[model samples]
Target: MRLSSLLFCLCVASFPVMAAGQGLQRSGPMRFLYDMGVSDTDTSDPTMRQQLLQLREAGINVLSLDGWDAAAFQKLLPTLKADPLFSRFKYVLKIHPHVSSNWAANPTQVCSDAANGVLPADTAQLLDGVAAFGKQNADYVVGYYTFDEPSNKGVNNGTTICWQYQQLVYQRLRSGDPDSTDRPVITANTLYPVAPEDIKNSVSPNAQDIVFVDQYSTDPAVQATEYKDWGNMLKKVVPVFPAFSNNITTCQDPMLRTQFRPAVQSGLNTAYGANQPAVAGIAYFAFYPGRTYAYDAQNCAPIFNSVVDDLQHDPIPVMTKIEPSLNLILSCPASSSTAPASSSTSSEPCQ
Candidate 1:
């Protein structure tokens, strides 16, 4: 569907807040996740937690970890695991350097044994180590991202990397005691011309996993093309699996300059993230700076907390104000989960 079509349905989203996401899942609203990786090391910062607390109270339940070491990560875990703000919110952590080799359980552990290599570089061993660590933190773990942006030209290898990472977490997930009611999710970043192997060879999206596609396009037309050619087409092959995604965070360095904000603020991204004919959601570039502007969700400003009120104070308003006209969107239900099933809630947020 074209952006024009989305413009039409935009009115329905603005309807009175009723429970939505019946066929989709969850209803309160899709996540306005501000990437929370910056606070991974700075455990002493009361301000970040305050922002997160604001987010939690506001109904945003998902928090994606941007970049950080497994060790420095530990200092922050207690708060995330215990704090009501983050305790129940979904947490996605990206292992630094390389998703596989770098994020081990030990704080002292580094994925790279040599500056040139990341640990054994053995795909199996690397997957195993990463899986074991994720299992320990499985309670809060929403998914494991193997690589930030893989440089693979071959679709098969591109897909192989995808499956290899899945196997790591899956095996550990089966072996570990469950804490969350959700299934394990894995993601790999691939750019356009995603080879057939990459597309065809990866894990089955139907197997209750997300076929996450991370892109960094800034052009609205290009973003629309991504929805049509990349996201829309992939859904035909794997409908349920290609449901969640993000723009790889659009940004420059740390914080967005006033210039980039106009593009992000434009309805393009809001539309693309909401623009699916079937089932899926889009997360913006990122929350803070220091990474790439391409990852920032709210590109208009660099300091995320000040503007996070959009997600925290008035998420529904933000969703209704700026969004694609699509019908299906996923969110957790009103009832608390006992199964750790990764369930898509049909009810709106806690309210």
Candidate 2:
């Protein structure tokens, strides 16, 4: 076996096993998902498998793909299933109607169906096709992400519509396949200010299995608050996965690679790893090198290693010690469930 693979196995075997009351348990339980765009049909990319191997070694158990469709997943599954190491890692397939349309189609912009108040005609068809795909690949498939950030404008508009739409798709998948590995519905909402309760309740634990909150802010203070608040809210309802970003709008932003970058990563590992019973794990934003950002996988090596180190060394005690100060500096008034939805809008995806 490769040195990286051997080390990764050793690190995973060393993780502190927890009891039932500590957190919700699931198959192949892992806390970090590296969210990026990867195709199953890249026959020419010889280095693709190596990059994925390195990622798994660095403690990322989930591969959350952004621009992947049902057809791409269908083509890719066999490749992953054939490899023992790759097959061990989980997958989050982003579903859309057409492969080309998914390149820019934001889940928030999906219009609601007039009759049933759910996704529009095109999106509904997309969900059905995606669910059928999930049924065909139940063992290795983890979940499906239909929407990016519904709390923002262009999606649910702070209303419960997005959650309702999630239910429509989630229920269909579950009812379609009653097997244990068939439950897979995932959504990642922006955790700026706070995630609205209306949207949160729309897909309760009974409706959806996992929820992710993104923290793209450069300010560590904001990152801490987002993690704590959103983590607490979604703890019991579903396993919370905090999302991180390697590069903002510009990949060369000095702040991103310098002060702000370390702070953001540290804050994520600390707040999410704090003895919180709800936080299942954390996920990073776009890992696509030339596609999503100029930053390559090498740029993320330190961050990935740090995450593995934190998990291996045991961050609970350290996080517990720093919790009080973080709460003090980042504290805010209780979020009002009735607060007005922000007018800020974005037609683009939240990657």
Candidate 3:
């Protein structure tokens, strides 16, 4: 379980073609976030280790614990800290809001009234908890994200206030933690059939700091364009890490069930989408079957494997190389060109 025994396997054979001299640099490789929220498997189980190893082999670097509460996260920290495979991975810790307030769903809507205080009691408590958790386990914790798809409705109390809340929460989370002050606070955004400009403007500036817009489309051309537009707009201000689906997308075909499952279609879309050149990296969503809470890896393997394969073979145009002296592994991707050499893909494990 020691870090020295770790190895990162890349399946480059599955890729279409590699441009000469274009290699996925050890420090600049795409970072994937894998959701283990609704998954039936738990990190405490024996099978969890194997799962983590396979994900690593497939090029996934971050494991997201979305559904786990703060107490549960604290309990699992030691196990994640000790494991070698985990040592190779970063984590997105999802901390729930304090009691009497459903901030995860809509902090802006719930705390709109003045009596709720300028920042609200639950919001401050949430920040305190996150700061403490982050300070205690700063090594493995890369960033924190709790809200899911907050921009569903146009900018309203639900959406606009959420940004304000995010500003406060992010400020509080990084208050005393000087090391992780620049860490990303990511949230999922809505992607309807409306004009792309509308969707772009709807996203909050705070939310755009670590952009992750999810779009599940049947057409790769459309998906590619969407990725490009979104990437162009968001990349200027923040790093863009979009989510790719594993579900099928042929909505008009006859015998829909008889056709490829959603996951199969998603896998195809992923294959086409990854080659778009605009895509920086992707976070794989295992929840298929109409977004039902389930992690059917058997159904999702095709897309997951395809995206991982693409990342391994295709080296993205390096945005900024890692500078080793900063000692800021979690925040390196968003950091400037002065980053130190990366330890995740390099021989040294990220400290």
> Evaluated with TM-score, which candidate comes out highest?
3
Quote model 3's TM-score: 0.58
lDDT of 2 by residue, 6-102 (tens): 0111112112323323432221233444433445235235344454444443344555443344666777777766655455555666652242143
List the candidate 1 regions with Cα displacement exceeding 4 Å: 1-34, 64-76, 96-139, 151-181, 193-208, 216-220, 231-282, 287-351
> Candidate 2 overall Cα lDDT vs. reference?
0.42
Please, what are the lDDT tens digits per residue for candidate 1 over residues 108-181? Answer: 23312322233333444444544555566655554544343332444323223343333444444334423222
Each prediction's TM-score against the native?
Answer: 0.47, 0.56, 0.58
Q: Candidate 3, residue 3: CA error in Å?
A: 32
Residue range 1-351, candidate 3, lDDT tens digits: 000011111111011212222222222233544445412345555344554444454355566544244566777766655655555555666543232134545544644632243566656666677656766765556566644444454433334234445455556666645443224555555445435554544444543334444554545455445544444334211112222343245112121112222332343245344332222234444333342212233444434344444444433333233433323243222211211111123333334
Ranking by lDDT: 2, 3, 1
Highest lDDT: which candidate?
2
Looking at candidate 1, what is the lDDT of residue 277? 34
lDDT of each: 0.36, 0.42, 0.41
Looking at candidate 2, the ten consecutive residues that score lowest on lDDT are 1-10
Task: Estimate the overall C-alpha local distance difference test score of candidate 1.
Answer: 0.36
